[model samples]
Every structure is written in C-alpha cells, then in structure tokens.
Target chain A: MAILITPETKIIVQGITGDFGGRHAKLSLDYGTQVVAGVTPGKGGQFFEYGAHKVPIYNSVADAAKATGATVSVIFVPPPFAADAILECVDAGLDLAVAITEGIPIKDMIRVKRAMTGAKTRLVGPNCPGIVTPGTGKDSFGGCRIGIAPGYIHKKGHVGVVSRSGTLTYEAVFQLTSKNIGQTTCVGIGGDPVNGTNHLDVIKLFNADPETHGIILIGEIGGNAEVEAARWIKANCKKPVAGFIAGATAPAGRRMGHAGAIVGGAEDTAAAKIAVFKECGIEVAATPSDMADALLRAAKAKGVTLT
Target chain B: MNIHEYQAKALFEKFGVAVPKGTTATNPEAFVTALAALPEGPTMVKSQIHAGGRGKGTFTNGFKGGVKFCKTKADALAMAGNMLGQTLVTAQTGPVGRKVQTIYFTVASDIKKEYYLAILLDRATSRPVIVASTEGGMDIETVAHDTPEKLFKVLIDPAYGIADFQIRDLITKLGLAGAEAKNAAKLIRNLYTMFWETDAAMVEVNPLITTPTGEVLALDAKVSFDSNALYRHPEIVALRDLNEEDPKEIEASKYSLSYIALDGNIACLVNGAGLAMSTMDIIQHFGGTPANFLDVGGGASKDQVIAAFKIILGDPNVKGILVNIFGGIMDCNVIATGIVEAVKEVGLKLPLVVRLEGNNVVAGKATLAASGLALVAGDTMADAAQKIVKLVA
Candidate 1:
C-alpha cells in the first residue's frame, strides 16, 4: 500500500562499479529488492549475483533499461557526476530515480531540475537516505533494513511518516516503534537544497494511500519547504497529523547540520514552521519524544486500537 | 571552504563577470606593494577576515582615521603596518576577537549604479536561485527583512541557462537603460556561469557597481565553496584558509566529523548536530550545562568515535560527558566499541550517561552489559538528560 516503491519494482544500479554503489547494490539484493541490472560506463557485460538471480550490467542507463526493463534507477555516482547520472536516468524513462550521492553542486541540480520539467520521471534525492516501505519489503537505497520497522512504536495504524533529515526519519520511526506503532510508509525526502521530491510531494502521495490514516512530519530549520508542505497538508490531507521541527534553539545564522539547515532569513526557522503547523490545527511535538507521543494521541483520538 | 575576495574575483573574471582589479596582501609590505601595483589615487583598504564587520572594527577604524588621503607609498605602508595583525573587535565578533589577517587594496569606483546580486541554492525549490535587488550596498539580511518586495529573485533554469527574458527583467528592476541594461544582463549570465564552475555554495556581489565610465564591476565579492564537492574542485581545496577556521573543527573534519565550538558548560558528544543542539537545549532547560557542540557525523568508525569522545573530554569546562547517539547508517554496536575503548584510554572520573538507538541496539546493549564504568544507558533523550542531570547535580 506504500507509494513510490514496492517489492515488485525492478531496480537498476547506476555507477554500480563504484565502491559505495557496489556495496549498496549487494545490500539491496541481500534485502530482497529486485535489482535487475547495473550501469557503469566501460564496465558493460559484467554480472553480479543476487542469490540465484544473476544481475547483468550495462554501460549506460539507456542500455540497462533496454536490456532489463528496470523501472527504478538508484544513482550512486560521485557528487560531480550525480547530475549527469540523474539526467541519464530521466532520458532512459525511469518511473522513479533515487539519488544516494550527497553534496551535489546546486547549479548542477538546477540544470537537472530544468531538464525534468513536465517529464514523467520522478527524482527522489540527490542527498537523501532514499525511501523504505516497511514489512512488505521495499527500499530504494541499501541502508534501510527490511522488516525492522523503527516506526512500529506507534501501533499498526494509518499514520504516514515524512521527514527531510535521513537520520531524523529513523529517529521518528524509532520513537513510534518503541510505542509499538507501525507506519504505512516512512519517507526520507532529504535535506539538500536541490533534492528530488519534497515534503509536499510526499504528502500528496500519502494523502491518497487509503491505508495511511494520519501523518508525522519531521523538519529542520532552513528553507520554506516545511511551510509549503504545511499549507498543502492543511488544505488537502484529511487525516490527523503531528509535526516536529528540529533546530528550534539553534543559534541564528549558523548552519547546524545539513548545508540546507542554516537559518537563512526570517521565513526559515523551526519556530516559524511549528507556528504554521500549529495554526493549521496540526499537533506539534516539542521534542523527539513529544513527537512520538503526539502521534500516539492523534491515533488514539481517532479511535484506532493498538495491537 | 570560503575563499578570499581576491580569489573569488579571479573566478568571476574567468567566467567573464566584470570585477575591479584587486590583490591580497599578507603583510604590511605586501599591502604597500599591492597598492603600488594598482592604479594610483584613493584606493580602498579593507581588512580580510572570515568574520564580517571589518569596516566598524577598531584597528581598521583607527588606521582609517590616521590616513589623511594617503598621498604617498610611505603613508600607505605606515597605515598598513599599524592595521596588520591587530585585533578588530566589531559588531560581528563581540569584544576582543578575530585578528586582521590580510588587507585588500583596490581601486575605488564611482558607483553610478548599485545592485545586489547573489546566487544560492534554494532548499525549498531545490534549485539555484539568483537573488537581485536594485537597492544595493546595504546588508542583505536587512534587505531580505525590511523590503523583500524590492528584490528580484529568479530560479535559474539549468537546461536553457539564465533565460534572456529573466535577465532583461532583472536589468529593468535594477533601473538600467539601453547599453547599461544589456551589459548588466550579460554580467548576470556570466556570474551564473562562475557560480556553477566554481561549485560555490554562495556567491554574492554586494554592490555590483556600474562605474562612471559605463562599466559594471563587482565591487565586493564573497564566495563559499561546497566543501563536499571539493573532491572535484582541487583548486578550491588548496585555497582553504586554515587560519580562519577553528582548529578543533578542522581536526574533526579529517575524521569526517562536524564539530562547532559553542559557549556552554556541558560538552556534548552526539551523532547529529540537530540532536546535539537539542540535547544542549534540553540540558539547559533542565538546569544543567553544555560546554561545546560536537556531532560525530554519520558512519563513524571506532577510532573516529573514540577521537570524538577524547575531543569533548579535552575541554576544561566539561564536568561530565553526555553521549547521545541515534544510530542509522552507524551501528550502535560500533559506537559501543568506541565508547568502551575511549573510556578505558581517557580514564575519566566524570559521570557519563549514554542514549543509544537504531541498528544493533540490542548488540550494543549487550556489549555494555557488564562495563562497571559510571555509564548509564537510556532509551530516550528525556530519560538520558534527566539521568545525566541527576548525576552532575
């Protein structure tokens, strides 16, 4: 019932010859993800085994797509080449592209975004931990463990978890898991300024998922992304949602964590985002623990019973 | 990752963005030599420190006061010598900080037209946004705050490049006419190219000035390079000013950890800065103290984790250690390995409390099972903070 990725989705690994790429590809295969092919220029005709299933490798994304019909492309190219890698995937007509590479130059992403306008292909991240659909066994990137639902602290209910910080997504999930609650899906939208997909984009997907009852959003200080997402959640999302904005106490004009997490001007701050979320009638978590509690109360108020 | 103005201007020049002729002077003698190299008469002297507010600094202000038009090379040398190595306490760096390392000597231009221009990655839109304002030379923070409407911000289309229409609109907003407008538009396009080529995190030209002779030149420049993208930009990597950075932060970067010094009493060792700062805030709220802010970063190894612990413990103000780790790509077991080993090596008598979560939590817990070290493990941040506060109190 999760959006974007599923067990049935065929995956292609771009830059699979690289160290990080090869490692993630092996792990993804180990996790039972249907990794169909690998793409690395000058390394075509190679093969990597995922159990009994032999995975073929191609030189470019276009060749890999033609050979294996891989719908989803997970890019592990270096920062400098990440933009070109994503562009290659888009050209190959991938249904979704998940970029694991961090620190991509903003201008390169700007060019990538320009090329993606009105295109059918959807990009997930240029600096993200990628997406994971728990229990049903689906993950875009390698690190997320299968069947290990950190969001299981919140009892099996309809709450969808969305976050910009990759680690914080796991934090929210861990909190929910501790409470014995499970999420329909947890998304790590990424904190890069020029990341693929966003909080609002994921909210739309979650809103349409019948299995998803409510939502929990974890955001950091920086940008108006949270504000934009809160507006969308208020207008469109019907389910109850809880929000937690990190970096509320961060010093003004300091980049606390992510490059994008800096307090830019007035509009980009945790306090401001929390205010917007509160004004929209969405319950706001004062801290990480508080966020998990808020989600619990939201589900309880909606008459959802714990298992 | 921030380059000096002279270096940034060189990058701007390469991309065909007009820039005033300037050179960096390391010493007072070099300052005089740089001033001699530039075309004579009333050149502006600016102290080059990473921290802003040099114009209002005591040393700079004192040097400027001593100068009566600096009509000769001797006068310039005397002024430069007096200013060099002197501490400049300003509004930016509160009393007694940041010595003037270098001074920038430049040919002053009669600014016929002033426009503010900056290229930054817009996190919300996930694109590079070129922010321009006709109201230039003032602080951008003030402009963004008071009169945001006066600014003309456009998301640069990476594919087609900065569109002709958008550039024209920006020029019009800048109140340029005819040839000046066309030239300004071209400058904007070139600046975009420079911004891309340099892998700049932020490229700002405060007072993108049009000289009296109908030439637009970047009067002041500030460029911050993407530290992560430094792998590809070898030239930028070489330009890193080690003196301008905190030694601890520099040392931590070698191990791929991000650490920032803060004025607090309780030194924190956390996995993420968001969590670290939050931990500090929680400690403060609970009437405990936080001395420094340290984020060991993701995927920390045993040695790096040990190094982080040692670095935090090294701080004199640190009475106790609060290790808050919400492991993800990093395994809790690995962190436990580091913590146990570091505690043995450092042999601290200070109270310690650990809050660990995520991958291999059970394994990590198992490793810490019989370690009789004054260590307490909590499942949550609240519990960990409360426990640490109790121990310290």
Candidate 2:
C-alpha cells in the first residue's frame, strides 16, 4: 500500500484551464489517475476533455470537492495566486493539496503555513514534482499520478522514496526500477526553503506504513530538515534507510540552483549532513548514482528483504 | 538580492532604524562634496561592495584596508580617493575583487558599547527570528560556536508579531537601561517592520552600537531581499547592483536559466535544480571538476538551450559539456532538439555527452542520433558523467 495516495484517490486540478495546468491535467488523466474535476474560477461550467475523460469544472475547490467527491487537488496556479489556491484547499477541507507551481514568494508561503496551523488538508509542494504511487499495470500505469512526476519510471512494491528534488527523485526511482526493485511511493517534498512538507514529515509516514520495507531519503544543503529526519530515524525507525545529500562542491552562502540549497551554516553543509547520516546508521550514497545500490546494501545489512 | 552597505543604511534610515550620518560618492572628484556633509570630526571611509569583511580587506592596488578611520575629513577624503575606482578583495569576494565604484563617508561615533542584532526567517520554526548578542562587531558564527550562551534569540510569532516582552528581554540581555533601552526597543520594532514589509531574506546589524550620549545606531548594515518577492518591491529591485554579479549569471537570469560559475573545467547543463546539483556531484565523483552549474529549468525551449550554450561557452575554463535531463513535465525530446540547434548555432568544438531520460526519452535519443552532430549518448546519468569525464580527460 502507498503511504499517501493510491489508485482510488480521486483528484482535481486547480488551474486546469492554463497551459501548464491543462497539459498536466491531460497527462494525469492519460496515466489513468482518477482525475475527477477541474477548478478555474470563471471557467466554472466548462469541462476539460482528454480522450474519453471529460472532467467537470467548478469555481472553487469546495464546489469541486462537493460535486465530484474529490479528496485531493494538484495546484498549477501561477506563483502570485498559488498560495491562495493552497488556502482554498485547506478551507475546503480536502484530504491533500499538491502544489506544482514554483516561484511563490516566501512571505506568501509564511502566511499560508501560519494559516494552516491545524488544517485537515495536507499540503505537499509549492515548487515540487509531486507524488507518484506506482501502478500494478505495465510501466506503472494504473496508480495515482498527482502533479508532474513521470509515472512510467515507478514500479509498485515495498520501498518508499522521498526527496526534495524532482529529477533526483526520478533518478533514484529509475535506478530502483532498473534493478528490478519496486516502490510503494515516491514523494518530492520540493526544494523551496519554506515548502509545505519536509524530509522528516514524509519519513514519518513511510515509517508508519507497513508495506514500506526500506526507504531512500534524498536531501540537499540548506536547512536542518535532513539532519532532523536522520536523528529521528536513529532514535525510532528500524527500517533500512539510504540517504544522499547534494551540494558537496557548493561554496558557502551561494545558492546552488534550488532556493533552499544554500550553505547557510556549518550544520547544513553537505559534509555535516553526511556525517549526521553516517552516525545515524544510514547507508549514505557516495554519489547520486549510488542511491539505489546504497539502499540495497542497507537492506542487506539489516536482513530486510526489499524486493 | 544583496544590497551594498550604503543602500542598506539608506533603507534602515527609511524604516526609522537610526544609522550614522553618511554620504556616498562614486568618484574621487565627488569626495570633497560628499564629505562636506560630515562635521569634520573623526570620520570613517568605507568601500561600497556587496561582500562583507571590508574593514580588514585589502585592495588589488596594495591599499591596506577597504575601510579606514581618519582623524580629520581631509584624511577621510584621501582614504576615499585610494578606495574609489580600485578593486577591494575580501575573504568573501574570492580572488577577483569587486571594483569599488562608490565610497561611503560617515561621522565615526564615540562608542559606549557594542551589540549585535539581526532579523531573519528561522527555517526550523518557520517564523521570523531576532538574533541578538552583547558581543558585537565580531563574527557571529565564532560567537555562536565558542560562547553559545552569549547569543540571544527571540522567535517572533508571525501571527502575533514581536511582543513587548521579547524586546525587553533582548534589551536586558544586552544590559541596556533607560534611554539606550528605549532606543533599542524602537530600533528592534522598526527593524522587524523593515524585514517583513520589504520581504527581506535577512537583515543584519553588526556592531549595533550605543554612543556616549545614549543614542543607539546601526554601524553596519547587511540586508538581502527575497528575489521571488522582488516583483512587489520595484524600489528594492532598483537597488540591485549588476556590477557585483557575474555577467554570465546576469545574462542567464534574463533567459530564466539558473547558472552559477565554478572554477573547474567541465561545464554542465541540466534540467531542474536538484538534478543539476547532483550532476555536479556525479562529475566530481568521476574525478572531474565542473566548470559551472547551469539549470535550464523545466520546460526549456529551443532558444533557452542556445542561450544556455552561449553562457556556458562564455567561460574560458570550460573544456567539455554534459547535458543531463530527467524530464517529468519537461519533455526530453525538446531538450535534445535544443541541444542539436545550440551545437549547430555555436559551431561546437568541445566533446558533448547527453543523457536523456523520462517523458519521450526514446524520441529524445532518436533526435540526437538523427542530428548527425557528432555527440555521444549515454544510457544513464552515471554512464553519461563517466563518458564526459573520460572524453574531457
């Protein structure tokens, strides 16, 4: 079983009328996800036509959820309005909201995060690749595909993968799939400094899931989220976890691509985080290419069968 | 998004955070007029550059310091002459120093005591935090490491804002009483306002000093704004000093490409930030040095690829190129087509290794193969990185 999503998780698209949102909405439908509804404010009575699928549109998240029984939403709204779209999902009391939009202002996110104090809806990424629970069909086709992750690389199985990078997550998933290993779910928590979910939050879910036998945790430099997660894993988790931290060659204070991937202090550097991972009994990947193999080694050491 | 010291001080003044009376001049000829505003007592002349450690920094012309204190305004003027138009290299500026286009002149205050204060987002708490210390005018990192107790942090609740009690606690921590305490409280409030209202990434006041007359002032200001929020603050965007940025980086920004120059020989062009960074790591793992970090971003157009190629080739250190794309929403065929066009337009000479995966990857590989552009294709990221390293070697 997947940690967050499954084939039965019906979902809606927030900006389903825009080019990016519309394109991904069609792709998600094509992947056999339960894409039930669309939300585009003024485009209320319209429908998004994708092959045989014709999803109804609503003016608000609440309306879409009520009419279509959609529990999840994938936001593709622009940066200026992305925060509000997230808030709408929270207000609608949807089960989860996955924001695929990037470049949202930090201040907007700060307020959104504050407003989500005890909300029912779980927010995923504002600058993330979203979540993919691999299907049982050929090329992982029948499972839930939220946001923009390439669905074909996933294989339904026991190992859970979580990361702050999109392509990096794909890299790990591809490696695992190539080795005939499968995953329960692959989550990209995003690379923004103030994203909704983090490495620790996703790890807790993976730890609780009985089907997730082993996990691959990918992180980069910047905040202490990875270290925090590693410490938690050391204290409580018995599952074999393989970790990889990027930005070993990144200079101090210079942001390397990701807004959150800057070397702020000594604790958040690649070396410091890797040291923490080692001390926490995590099998750290020497390079990004070794993520899958590192997990395999960890599982073997723990005698945890991952296949 | 970092602003110069003078620009930060001006911003501080606008936010009611008092600073030393100062004036700036961009040339030696304007030094007389700029220093005329000061009362001719002990004055400080400082080079205007984005990086810190200016006081202890040395100029390329063998000048001793980027910042100097003079007994008279004439001495200040002379020091400004030595700094203006000269390149000042600091610990943070790397080997190639920034040219000091402007010099700041201020009336050096009689210091009664020094304290440190800053306002920035605490990533763990996800709130604004005020870091204060009695031990000022020194490296905060050193203070945090050696004497952790000396540092005082007030995590402000963004919902309720900074409370009066937190400010009072800070004032007591700094051992301030009466007039100085009152001044520090107001300064802290105003600083928070500036930080929130301006959407600042960080606002630091090193050596937040109290004068002999019990007046509190910001002696040094280091402020950076969030680039994503820059659209709302045109005034802050106006303060952007393009001279302080690499020309290639600035050009990359124009085309929505994320590029950071490095000191290696193999340049990498990839899609997505996380993949770009790991691409660098994989290259290094294979005993190769990456010359630059370039993320053409998701959904890169054909023009962006050409623009990215031009920017990468601009660096003379680059000997070969690696293009790694694990496309999700970003189609790999588009990237492959762009690479072909970029190579043809730029008249390629260097060995290029391309690795394409996910979302029409087969078509992407076919596009590269059909181009007849003399490029090598790898099956995976590791294979591609290894191939480029060997070719470049």
Candidate 3:
C-alpha cells in the first residue's frame, strides 16, 4: 500500500556510468530494489556490475524501458543534462522519474515542469533525496530505494513521511524507527524553487493512501507550498499529521543552503508556516528532535495506532 | 546572484529593454567623466550596492542618502563623492551596512507616470508571471499589503509565451495608452526574453516609467540570475562583484561548501542543507545563538572539514562550535576522522560538540573516542546542540 513504489517495482537508473550514479545504483541494488536497467545514452549493451547484481545498460531510456520493462527511473545525470534526462523519462512514458541531481538551472526545471503537465511520468526531485517505501526485510532492506536516501533507516509500516530536506527526512524517519514506528513511504520533494513535486502534491498522495495512518510533513522557509499543504490537510485529510518547519531563526533574504529555502516574504516564513500548521490541527514538532513524538501525540489524539 | 543596478541596466539594454543611460565610476576622480556620459539636465546619483531601499539609506559619514537627484553635473559629482566610499545603511542591509564601492550616474527621466513591473516564476502556477502595478517607485510589499487591487499579475504560459490579450489587459490595468502602451508591451516582451534567456531568478523594475515623451523605461533594475545556471552564463558570472559577499562565504564556495554568516555566536558545521539549518534551529531552541550556517554537503572530504573549521573560526563572534552529521550516503567514520584532523590542524580553543549518526556511526564514535581530543560527544542533534549551548554558557 505504499504510495509511489514498492519492493516489486522495477526501476532504471539514469546516468548509471557516472561515479555518483554508479555508487548509488549499487547501493540501491544492495537494498534489494529491482534495478532492472540503466540508461547512459552512449553506454549501451554494458552492465553495471556490483556484487551479484549486473544491471543491463542501454543508450536511451526508451531502449531500456522497452527491453527491461522498467516502469520507473531514478536520474543522477549532471545538472546540464538533468533536464533532458527528465524529459526523456516523460517521452518513454515512465510512471515516475526521481531526479537526484542538484544544481539544474531554474529555467530548465521550469520548462521541464511545464512540459510534464498532464504527462504520465511524475517527476520527484531535481535537488532532493529520493523516495523510499520501506521493505519488510531487516533494516528495511529489499524495498524500493530510489535516490540517495540511506536505505537502512526505514521500517515498513503505515506512517507516511514527506519532506523537502534530505537529512531532515532521515531525522524524522530515524526518530520514528527508534520508537518502533514504521512508515509506508517517505518522499523528498526537493528544495529547488522549481521542482517536480510540492508539499501539497505529496500530502494528497499520503492522504489518499489507506495504509498510511499518520503523516509527517517537514518543510522550511520560502514559498507558500507548505502553507497550501497545511490548509488542504485541515479541510480534507482525516489522518493524523505532524509537521516541522526549519529555518525558524533564519534572517530574511539569506538563502539557507537549499535554493528554495530562502525567506521570500512574510507569508512564507517559518513562523507563518508553523502558525498555519498549528491552525490546521497539525501537531507541530517544536524541534527536529520532536518530530516522532509530535506524530505520536497527533496519532493519540486521533485514536489511531501508527505502529 | 544579485547584480548591481548599473549591471542590471546594462543587461536590460542588451535584451532590448530600455533603461536610463548610465555610467559608473569606482572613484571620485572618475565621477566627472562618468557624469559627462549623461545629458546636461538632471542626473541621478546612486550608490551601487546589492541591497534595496538605497534611496532612503543613510551613509555612515552622515551623508543623507545613497541615491540623490541633482540639477547639474557638478552637483551629481558631489553626491557621488559622498557615496563612493562611505557605508550606506538601509532597511535591507543590516545595521553594519555595505561600503559603496561604485557610483552610478544616469540621466533622470521626466516621468509622466510610474508603474511597477517584474518577471518571476509563480510557484503556484509553475510558470513565469508578470507582476504589474500602477503604483510604483515604492515598496512593492507595502503596496501589496495596502492597495491590493492596484496590483495585477499576468501568468505567461511557457508553451505559448506572453499573449497579446494579456499585454492589453496589463496595459489597461496600468492605465497606459497610445505609444506608452505599445512601448510597455514591447518592454514586457523583451524583459521576458531576457528572463528566459539569461536564466534569471527574478527581473524587477520597481518603477517602470513612462516619460513625458511617451518612452517607456525601466527606471530601476534589480536582476538576479540563477547560480545553478551560471555555468551557461559566463558573461553574467564575470559581472559578479566579490566585494558584496562575505569573504568567509566566498572561501567556503571554493570548497563547494554552503555557508552563510549569521549574527549569533554558536558556529555550526553540519552535513546536508536541511540538517545544517535544523542544527541552527536546534541551537536556538536550546537558547544558544548560531553564528553561521555551514553545510559541508554530502560526502565531505578531509580538506573540506578543515576548510569549514577555518571558515567558522574566522567569525570572531563564534563562542562555541557544534558539528552535527547525519551520514546517509556519507560514511560517519570518514566524517569523524575528518573532524579529528580538522580540530588538530585548526588548533581550536572554543568548546566543540560533535554528533555523528547514520552510516558507520559506531566506528565514527570509536574514532572520536580514540582521538582523545578535548571535544564533547552527543548521541543526537538535540543532545549535541544542548551540550554546545551549555558549554558556551
């Protein structure tokens, strides 16, 4: 009942020949994901060899998808080519494309996003830690581990975690795992101002998933995405949700690492987002360390068992 | 990256977007020559800095304004002299202010009316939007708050570009007519071209003026390009003024580290941007102020750790350091070893708290224990932030 992917989801890795792509592709394989094929444009007919897993490589996404029957792709292409890689996934009609690459130009992403309108391929991130639907195996091994997120911290269960920050997502997941709480899925929509997915998009998916009993929504300063998501959750989502927004102490106009993490105006500040979350009946995590406990409180108030 | 007003004006001209003819001088001696490039009539003397609210800014030397209107070239030159080297404190620029290293002189246009125009991505629609208003030459935020109806927006479909109907709607909203309307339409088209071609994050013309002669001009230009797209725009990169940035931040960029200097005293070095920001928040939560936000990125090397330490230590306000790492793809042991080496190399006296989690954390903790450095260890981010705050307290 994971939202986007599962242990049985067949996946392809774009930019599989590069150092970063190859390394993560191997890690994804080690996590027991069904890494069916690889796409490197010019590296066709080759195979990425890691331990016993030898994933075949094709020159194009279409070729890879056609031969291997892979439905999803995780892109690790460099920024300059990342946009084209995303478009190729749309062209090949992949169910989803998880872009792990960062630093893609905003213009490129704006075009990529525009082109993806009404398309079948749902793009995840251009500057994000990807998605994970935790496996039932030990340490959440054998799950659909897509991007650069560490595969070991996850546990298979009902709580859905969605965030824009990589380590913050891990922080929440780790907190949940430590308390013996498992998650149905975890999605990082990314920190880029022009990303494929937003907080609202992932929240809707989580709310729709019957298996996801509770949700953790992590956001930061900048953009009205978090506010939009919070308002939506209040009106429609009946599931328990905990929220955490970073950059509370951040100064105005200073970009805090993430391209989209800057405080643009009064509406998008951490304070404003936190207020909206609280107003929406969300149990707000006072600190990053309290994310798991906050969710527990929300679940208890709703009389739902997350574990 | 934000370019100076003069640079933005030059870029505007390149894209067929009209602006007041301007010249810049870095020294007072060249102010006269720079002023000569403009007409004999009224001129605008502006301090070239990255921040806004320059028109109302006061200089440290007791000079009245960063921007001034003068009737003669000699008067413009005098105003330029007052601004060229003095620090101008504005609402946007913190109390410390920024040194005015360059002076911009432009021929003042006789405004028939002032309008506001900007091209930026609309996050809601995921498209380029033109925010236009009849109210201009003032804080747009204020206008948005007080007179919301005066402001209008036209979302440009990336697929079809700006439509003629949208332009007409915008022109009507702005109360433009005849040649002014035609000129404004052209300017909007050209501005969109520049925004798309240059990969600009935002193109803001605070007062898009229609002169008495019916010529539409961008009276003030504030353009920022996407740093991610800077590789394709070497021309824009060349316009980068290093003087406007913190030296420590510039140094951090050289090592691919993301660092921003803050006003607090507790310096934080962490892995991942989100975690780094959270570390700062956690520090603040514990009643300790964070001096800086430094993300060493994933897979930080030994050299990067040393560089980060140097940058954090360079800030005189820093009383203690907190190193938080949640190694995902990153190996915790590698980071721990790097931290140990960084401390040994930098010769730290400030109290330091290190928290390592995730991959190879056991080995990482063991490495730190064996190093025997005078560093406190925390089991989690909360523990680490509290430890640093308490130690510094």
lDDT tens digits by residue: candidate 1, B1-393: 787777788788888988877666887557756877878666666667665556655753454321123555455556667666877766656564667788776666677878888887776555777888877888776776688788778876555667889888878877888778777888899988877777788888887988777888898788887676778778888888888777778888788777776666566788765576677767776778777677787668899988887777766777777888887667889998889999999887888888888767888988877676768887788888878887878
DockQ of each: 0.40, 0.57, 0.56
Return the TM-score for each candidate structure. Answer: 0.89, 0.98, 0.98
What are the per-residue Cα lDDT tens digits for candidate 2 across A174-283?
99999999999999999888888989999999999999999999999889999999999999999999999998887667862211222244568888999999999999
lDDT of 2 at A262: 20
Among the numbered candidates, top DockQ falls to: 2
TM-score of chain A of each: 0.88, 0.97, 0.97
TM-score of candidate 2 versus the correct structure, residues matched by position: 0.98
User: Candidate 2 chain B: minimum summed lDDT over ten consecutive residues — where?
Assistant: B120-129
lDDT of each: 0.74, 0.91, 0.90
Estimate the lDDT of model 3. 0.90
Interface quality of candidate 2 as DockQ: 0.57
True contacts kept of each: 0.41, 0.64, 0.60
lDDT of 2 by residue, B139-214 (tens): 8888877887898888888888889999999899889999999999999999999999999988889889999898
How well is each residue in B1-393 modelled by candidate 3, as lDDT tens digits?
989999998989998999988999998788878877787989999999999889899999888889999998888877787888899999988999999999999998898888888888777777888888898887777777788788888888888888989989899889999999899989999999998899888888989999988999999998888899999999999999999998999999999999999999999999988888889999999999999999998868988988999999999999999999998878999888988898998889999999988989999999999998999998888899999999999
